[model samples]
Structure formats: C-alpha cells, structure tokens
Target: MPLVLFVDMDYYYAACEELRHPEAVGKPMIVGTGDTAAKMSGVVESCNYEARKLDIRSAMPVAQALRINPDIIYIPADHDYYDRMSGRLMEILKAFGYRMEVISIDEAAVDLDSMSYEQGLVQGKRIKEEIRKTLRLPCTVGIADGKVLAKIVCDSAKPDGLKLVERKDIVQFLSEKSADKIPGVGKKTAEKLEAIGIKTIGDIAKSDLVSLSSAVGSFGFELFQIANGIDESRIVEHYETLSVGRERTLDATKDVQKIYLLLDELSEEVYREITKNGFRFRTVTAKARYSDFTDKIKSKTLGYWTDSPEILKQTAKALIRELIEEKPIRKVGVRVSSLEMGNKQMKLF
Candidate 1:
C-alpha cells in the first residue's frame, strides 16, 4: 500500500513571470505571445486565471487571445528560467524522501508510501509554503492512494489549493464529477461513453466491464479501474522517457549537405545528453518540419544499445535520405530513445 502525491503548479508561466516581476502582481498575464508583424501567428503558452477568464489560453492563437483581451500582458516563453526553478524545486522534494516522477514541466507525482497521509499532508503544505516564500511560485498539492486519484485531486485543487483523497473517499468524490475528470477520458471518449449511457464516473464504475472493454479495447478496462479507484501504477525511480531530442529552427537553406551538417551537430548534442545521464538507447530518430509546419519522424532501432554520436548520425542520415516527402525544411531534430541504464548489467526473475 502506497500513498501518491501530485504537485501541480498554477499557471506556471504566469507564476514564473510574477516571481521575476513583482510589478506583474494582480495583473492579467499571458505567456508565449509575441508582438510580431506576422498576423494570426504565435501561440499562448500559459495564462493567469484572470487572463483565462477572458478566454486567453495556452496554444491558442495569439490573435484570438487578443480579441478576448487586447490588454492581456504577453511574454515569450522562458524555458531556461522555468528549468532552473524546477530543478531547485525537485531538489527540495527529493530531500523529503519522495521518489519523484515528473509528469510534465509543471507537474509531478511523488510516492510517499512509508509516510502517513496526515504527515504527508503536513509535508506537502510545508513544501508549498517553502516554494511560495523562497521561489515566489504558487502550486497545488493532492494526495491519494494512487497516481490517477492523486491527479484528479490535484486537478480539483487548482489555483493554489490542497486536498487529499483517501481510498474510502474515492467513490464519493468522483460520484458527482464529469466523466472527463478521469484521466484518458477526453471529449471524444466521453461522447462515445455517453452513447453507451456512461456520463459520470459512477456510471463508468458500474457499467458492464465486458461491454466497455469491447468498445475501447484494453484502454476501456484501464479507464474502468480509474473510475473505481483501482489504480496500481507506481512512481518509478527512473523516468521511462520514450525519446530524448534536440531541435533547431534553422535559417532557410536549400543545400541538403548543410542541412545534414546541422543534423549531425544536433545528433551529437542529443547523444551527449543521453550519455551524460548514464543511459544507452536502441532507437535513433530524426524529425524534419517543413516551412509549412508539416513534419515527419523516421526512426530505427539497432540490435544493441548505443550512446555514440557516430552511430546516431549514421542512422539519422539514412532516415533523412528517405524523407523526400517534405517541402523546404524549417526545423530539424535528432532523437534517441528506448533508453536503459548502461551499467545495470544484471538479470532478475
């Protein structure tokens, strides 16, 4: 039996801005919007609740967001800034003996099985307070028996709130929520479920398992488990990243040789990143995006683990040769994934 805790930052970009600029307090803010000559371009990366009230949102066209709130404070994404802050935050959490699982740039899951929920809550609160006082960042915390319930509780505790959902309270907590509140239950999935008369978590929990499984395959059974608070997913010590990549938006160039040169540089960079983490990968992949945003990924898995830049470049070059389908390239990337610790030379039953 383990306790899972989810920590979700509120309007991460906006909060990060507020931390850097005290003058931004109490103002509607949006990130990733740029003042550019290009019309209907750029996207909102994140927005404060105040800006969200005006329909400003992440990944929405900046022009559309301006239509909702012309005065919305806009800033370009500061990923380096966020990364530094996140690193500090992770260090603090790790000190508390929570095995961290980074879910995204702004969220994470921590396993606290050895600690009592009440003590976990106290620790969670202290972590929040420390983040606010030291980093000037706002965050939400949720605790439950598993990752799914923890995420649900974290969602409900948004805008800088805290909540704990224990096993006994799962059903009651989910009874009145929308089906979409369950992870993996998106709009299309919910509509399909509704077509079969499943609109709420309770409906899903009590639905016929066999019929549900037939509708969505193995995913249906997984959803049913979440609906009934039966999640068994654990917070693994090492993150199982499918890929590690580096991309660059290059200046327009028609020379294939120059493009390949850049790709080699990117491949070497990616290889260094993987080896630096003491990992070896079997798959090497390349991505090319045309000026029109159309993109394609080509991948190859070697029969063995490789952390060498030479092999990665060779694989990427072969993939690029086969990518005659794209137009003038605007972005190029190299990736290595299917990773495993290089020195864990052992076998277990």
Candidate 2:
C-alpha cells in the first residue's frame, strides 16, 4: 500500500505576519483584508490559535473580532508576500523528490508510493523540521494510505504536529469520526445522512448501499468506500490556471472617477499577466463588495478572443457600473477568463 503525506501550514497568514514581526509571536493576532485606516470594516482572513480560543474565526468581521478581544493585533493581508512564501515552501517540498500535489497556497500532498509506515513518519518529521527551520513557520503532517485520509489526519493534528495512520488501523481510526469529518461531507450532506439515521463513519460503513444511494445520490458510494477505509483519490500533480484576477479594498466611496481609476489599474494588472502568459481571454468580470460586505458581480463575454487592454478595461468598466449604483463599495475586483493560449487561437469561418 502507498502512503501519502499531507502538509498544512498552521494559521498560514498569521504565521507569515509573525515571521516578519517576531514580537507578535504567541499573541492574539489576525491577518485581515480591510484597509489599515479602518481595519474594523474589513474581514478576518486568518487568525492565530490564541484568537481561535476567543471564538474568532476566518471570514468573521474584524469588528466582531475586536468585540471579542479589544486588544487583538491586526495585520492587513499582503498576498504578494504570502505567494512568495508559498513558492519557497513548495520548493522545499520539491527537494524531497517525491511526486507532490499543491493543494492550496498553504497545503500540499506528496505521494510516498509503497513506503513503509515507519519510513513515512520519519520523512514527515524531516519535512516539518525543514519548514520550521527555513521558513520559521509551523505546519502539520498526516500520513495515510490515501490523500483524503492523509488530509483528514493532518487536519486533526494541527499547529505543528504529525501523525501517521497505517493501513491496518485505517478502519478503527475512522470508525467513530463524524460523517462530516469526511472531506466532502458538508452540512447539507450531513443532513442527508442524518435523515437516514447515519451519523458516523461507522454507520456509513455498515449502511445499505441502496439507502445511502437514495439519500445522497451517486456520492453515497464514495462515502461508503471512504468509511470502509478504501480511497481511490489520486494526487493530481498539475492544475491548470482557469482565470487571472486581482482585487483590492479601498476607502468606502461612490466616487465614480475614483472607482473607474482603480478599475482601470486592476484591468491593466490582469492584462499584463494574461499577456505575459500568452493567454487571450474572451470574458471579463467585475466585482463590487459593498461596505456591509454584500457583493455583486457582472460579466461580459466577447464575440472573439483578443489580448486588447482597451477592451478589457472598457468591458470591466461597463460591468462595474451596474453594480456600483446600489451602494458605496469598499472593494472592487477584475477578472479575465474563458482563456485560450494565444498560439491556440482558432480562425473565424
């Protein structure tokens, strides 16, 4: 049996902030998306364990977090810096020469095909140590026979911890866990299972396939397999880019000129990246996030693909105009999708 290692950075954004400002270590801190001048208006992107203990959470309004802890530290998000750190982390993982899948900016799964469980544990510790020594960031690792199980184990041992679930122990390890503990079992799926008196992984393992299938459709088979400690999920080594985009928070404003200027700037940034990558896009999208956190989006698809900045800017402006009429926007974004490689452009009939 193959073993897979899932690595997840602990409180990634907050950890990155602490790396740069060592004084903030062990303090309740959050990395948020609001402007520095009025951080309370923004949303929490990530928070440290200290903040978690106070019931603060990601996507909670910063104002609500402040209400929870009046003195919690706040750091605005720096996505560019975080991306650089993520690149370095991936490079470190690459050095191990194992087939790896980048799960997210802060998570990855590496295949250790046919490796013994004992050796997998040793490699897990080495990975944890390398990330800590080089990046000064904490991470957790979970080693199991399958990627999903590895990720579940990794999630259970968080904030600088490691665990390995050998094939022999997979059933017992998963038996008592809630069905929701399975990756794809969200609230809706859990509700469906509950309706059929299935509440635990053990229940699913023993469930009648016909009933389980009736409850959740085709996904029921997957749940049944997962509950039985059988996982067929594979590590996808490459993920293609489907879109390019950028967003920024700003002082609350309805000023059309200021909004348009920012939109133009964002469009140019998107244009530069797509052009650099030799992609010509047929769709442009504009997004507006209101002061109260509600958002609206509009998209326009062109009749043909082109790499024209003017069309990108003009289409974005037109789309955003319909959104901004309702309220003062606190943030705006632009995206280009339906992408085709410039070299792959098709001839018109």
Candidate 3:
C-alpha cells in the first residue's frame, strides 16, 4: 500500500481576496460567481468562515448572501492568478519526489511509500509549512495510507492544520465520523443511509455486505470498504484528458431556442476534438447548472459510435430536454466520453 499526502486550501478564493485587501481580514468576504454582484444570476463562489456564519456560503446567490451579510466585500475569481501560485508550489513538491499527482487545481495526492514513517511525516510538514511561507496562503495537509483516507484526514485538518493517520488510528478516525463525511457520499445517499439506521461510518463499517449492497447499489459496497479504512487506488502522475467543453452562465431569460443553439455550438466543438483524434464515443453527457446552483448530469448512449457533429448535437439536444428545468439556467456543458478506436476488424490474411 502507498502512503499518500493530501493538501487542501481553506476558503481558497476568500483567502486570495484577503491577501490583496488586508482590511477584508476578520470581515465577511465572498467571491462573486460571475461578473455581476446583483440578482440571483450571480452566486457566491467562495466566502470566509465569517461570511459563512452569517448564512453566506459558496454557491449561494449573491443577492441572498447580501441579505445575510450586507458588509461583505465581493471579489472576482482569477483562476490564472491561482494557477501561477499553484505552479510555484508544485515546483517545490517536485524537488521532494516524483510520485505526485495534482488531483485538482488546489489539491494534490503525493505518494511517500518509499520513505520511513518519520521521514514521511517530516516531508509532509515541510510541504505544508513551505506553501504557507512561500505563497502566503493557508493549506491543510494530511498523511495516510491511500488517497481517500488522506483526503478525509485533510478535510478534518482545515485552515493550515496537519494530521497524520497511522494504520492504528485509521479505524478510530473513520468510525467516529458521519457517513456523509466520507468523500463521495452526498446528501441524497446520506439521507438514505440514515433511514436504515446507519448514520455514522462505524455503523456502515459494521453493516452486513449483503444488506449494504441491497440498500445503495455498488456505492454501498465502496462505502463499506472506505469505512473499514481500505483504499487501493494509486496516484497516477498523469491521468488522461477526459474531455474539453465550455459552459456559459446564462442570465435568467425565457429563450429556450437560444439555449438550444448554444448547446449545438458546444457539441460542435466536442465533435471537432473527437474527429481530430480519430476517437469515437459511446456516451454523450450533458450537464445543467440551474440559476440556484443546483446541477444535474444526464447521458445518452448511442446505438453506433460516431464522431459526427450533427449527431452529437442531436443527442445533446435530447439530453438537455430531459434534464432541463423550467427555471432559469445558469450554466450548460456537453462532454463526450467512453471513447476508443471506431472498430476492430480481425481477418485471416
């Protein structure tokens, strides 16, 4: 088993704002979802704990956030800015070892199985401290046996905190927490588990495999393994690029046909990429981000794999209709995955 290190930032956008505006420290601060700060069209992309205490949170509408904390300073997001700092931090990590994976823009998974326990702990602490000192940002780092457990540990150690999960303490740490606290278990799944009298991770860990499978499909089986502090997924240096698609955060408007045209345009872009690479996809997935920040994904499998823009657009349009809500749409995206060479022919020559 590989030892993993997970680094997570605390109130990332809010912290970035505070770095520029020192006065915003200790005051409620939030990052606006889009260019505007008015209406339900714009949501809070991130907010400090102070803002969160006032019912201002990430993904909450700016209008609603203002109602909660009127004095909050709104900052626009700058992924480019964050990216520059993140790159510098990764350069520092590269000096330490090669078995590192940048999981997200802000977080990463690093393997330290080659080092001793004490050596790994020291390296983890150094990475955490160095990031703060170099970037003037707060990060929480966790050390555990695998990626999922490392993330759980990092979640527990927010705001420049660090926690090391030894093999002996993994069971105790997971058991005391709620199942919802597990990485992949969302609100719907948590509620379902709660209905079955399995609220805590400990209960899920102790649950019978047969009953667990019957309750929540394969997710239950995965959750069961997680509860027992077992994760086998390794950190890959580079994962394949799945798909590339852009979505716009549209304003609240009653223009269904216009939205359809936009979806077609996006599908055309995806089609170009697949054709360029000679890739044919079996599945086309469409995502909808509602004005309220609620999102849903719907996918349609094709009878025949093809890299045709016209066909992709048609499939995407169908998916959009089924998943679309009557309410205003904030964002939309199309993705084509499950890609491979078009067909294989075996002939005796």
Task: Tell me the lDDT of model 2 at 252.
Answer: 93
Off by over 4 Å in 3: 36-40, 239-349
The runs of at least 3 residues in candidate 2 whose Cα sits more than 4 Å from the true structure, single-residue gaps closed, are 240-349
lDDT of 2 by residue, 160-229 (tens): 8999998889889989989999998999999999999999999999998899999999999988988888
Error of 1 at 14 (Å): 4.6
List clashing residue pairs in candidate 2: none
Candidate 1 stretches greater than 4 Å from native: 13-26, 32-39, 76-96, 129-136, 206-220, 241-273, 281-305, 313-349
Q: What is the lDDT of every predicted structure here?
A: 0.77, 0.87, 0.77
Residue 184, candidate 3: Cα error in Å is 0.9
TM-score of 3: 0.69
For candidate 1, the per-residue lDDT at 73 reads 69
Q: What ordering of candidates by lDDT runs from best to worst?
A: 2, 1, 3
